[model samples]
Target: MFAIFKIFFGLGWVSFGGPAAHIGYFRNTFVEKLGWLRDEEYAQIVALSQFLPGPGSSQVGFAVGYQRAGLGGGIMAFLGFTLPSVILMLLLAVLSSQLTESSYFQNVVHGLKLLAVLVVADAAWGMYRNFCKSPLTVTLCIGTAIALLLFQSVASQVLVLVIAAAVGVRYLAHGNVTKDKPASATRSFSWLPLASFFVLLLTLPLVGTYSSSVQLFSDFYQAGSLVFGGGHVVLPLLQNIVGDQLTQDAFLTGYAAAQAVPGPMFTFATYIGYELMPSAPLLGAIIATLGVFVPGFLLLVGVLKNWQQLAAIPAVSGALVGVNAAVVGLLLSALYQPVFTSAVITPLDLCWVLLGALLMKQFKLPIVWMVICFAAAGFMAPSVANLI
Candidate 1:
């Protein structure tokens, strides 16, 4: 457990890039370096995470720890991996009032927003390559992306995924059956976590009316529960939930900060929680963070041990393929909207993004170096414009 915590805690400090990058990092560390799990096991955990609604990479990390130690290990893994961003986000919330008006700070935020564009684009492309190999999957990916681009809402997101799953079952299930035996009997599996998941989902709203704090938790919990694609997809849901309470600028700033940080982007909740409750900021932060993370963890725990059995089913495996393709589309839509539209304002900005992509693809610079380069460019952008 301690080892799990230590490894993830270290990762929390250096895991730049988004969920896709984090997944790569986990593969390298746990699979390649540490030998904690085999390549196939890691892939299984990742597939399970994608199939479930949650923070994709973080769920993978949690399942890794769970595989190593158990539930306690999973908790430690989440805390270790999440702590740095939680601290950074809370601090950003505390400092944002002083920094928001500073021109230099605004420039840095802009840089990070652009960074978000590059990260999301990279993730979308990578997923597309991995999941959209077949004609049906390519069609699902394109269709889902077009649909979301047209109708941007949580309901639409859910609808596309459901439709994609049905399509996959109809068209893709025939030859996908696996012969692996079930890992454990159903009677031996624990259902407590699933029960708890439903109980909270049903009861949180009932209790939310009694306290603003509870309402905040409920809103974030819903966001975490419903976010299917990745952390990037959480933006619209959060914006709709808290937009009236916080200014668009504040919300966007927090998002950019999440991108700038080096851990799970879901820690954006920590910032939101602090902003929502100025009086007892820490309490709000803790509650909101826990709320957003709990449902995902619960669902993961409920399904982790039994995932092999489910994956062995031809229909389920087929559905996963469609789900994965749809996720790529969801991410592609996200890249264009809030990420690209919000960040790329000028032709110069587009050029910078292209250059960054080149550096990442051809030069193969580390993400930290990319962050430094983009930030420096942002800081100098105004001065360079003046000279021009």
Candidate 2:
């Protein structure tokens, strides 16, 4: 358990690019490379994580943790994956009051925006490899990708995903269900865990009034439970929750600061917690961190018990395959909205985007360095202001 915590705790610190990148990172490090799990099992977890309510990356972190240790392992993994960014974000929130003037901070933020685009692109590529294996999948991936790029909303893309899956299931798969073993439901729950989770979830909104600690906890916990897309999508929502009700300038500044950092955006929530109420920053910070991350853990465990049921349905399985393909499309849409839209403000910027893409796919450059170079260049360029 300790080892699990240490390793995953370390992962939390470094894992970047939101949930899709995190998923790719897990697949590469744990599945394809470490041989810790079979591909099919990993896909099962990926599919299972999607059905949960929070960020997909958060759920993946929980499942990876569970796979390594069980309940304890899962908890450690989430802590590990989340702790780094949370600490960094909290520190950033503290620092934002002063750090806005730092050139280093600005440059880093500039680089990060570029890096985030690259990271998301890499994530899309990985998803494509997994989901674009069949013609039906390709159609869903491409069609949804186009639709999302046009409409440009996560909710819209989810609608497209559901509709596409339904059509694909009824027509493409001929309404056939996948045949499998007669699966029985998991008898894994204790009433205590379920009851406690519901009770906490129901009352989370009422928490922050007691103290800043309560406020921080409630804010993050609520976000952890409610966010549905992935880590990136959580950004604007988190900003609204922490920033709007707190200090607008400080929250926005911290968000900018988080962009400059090298880890997960979820960590940014920690920064919001610490900065918003610093009279007792430690308690607020700790509580806020736990509150946001705990939902991710619960979401994973809750979904895992039902994963076998999804695996059992052939029609549902086919629909899932379509949905998984749509996930790739959804990612592509995300790339366009922020990545391409922000980065391609000029011809020079387009060159950089193409260069960065080539470096990633053709030369296989390290994402950290690729992001850094382009971001620096972009920040230095005369057109940088136009892009930002």
Query: Global lDDT for candidate 1?
Result: 0.81
Against the true structure, candidate 2 has what lDDT?
0.66
- 243-345: candidate 2 lDDT, tens digit per residue: 4557777666766665555445666666766655667776666776677667766656765756656555666666767777777787687677765565456
Writing each residue's lDDT as its tens digit, candidate 1 over 1-388 gives 8988998998887676677657766865787568998754665676577668889889999999998898999999999999999998888888885665678977876775676677778667766777889999999999999999999876787788889889978887765544553434354466999999889899999999999988989999988988876778888888988868999889988887887777888898999998889899999899889988888999999988777567557776677777778877877887787678878998778888999989977998866687788888888889877876
RMSD of each: 4.5, 4.2
Off by over 4 Å in 1: 1-57, 64-73, 174-189, 200-268, 272-281
Best by TM-score: 2
Candidate 1 backbone collisions, by pair: none
Looking at model 2, the pairs that clash are 8-80, 9-80, 12-81, 89-271, 90-271, 177-314, 177-315, 178-314, 208-214, 208-215
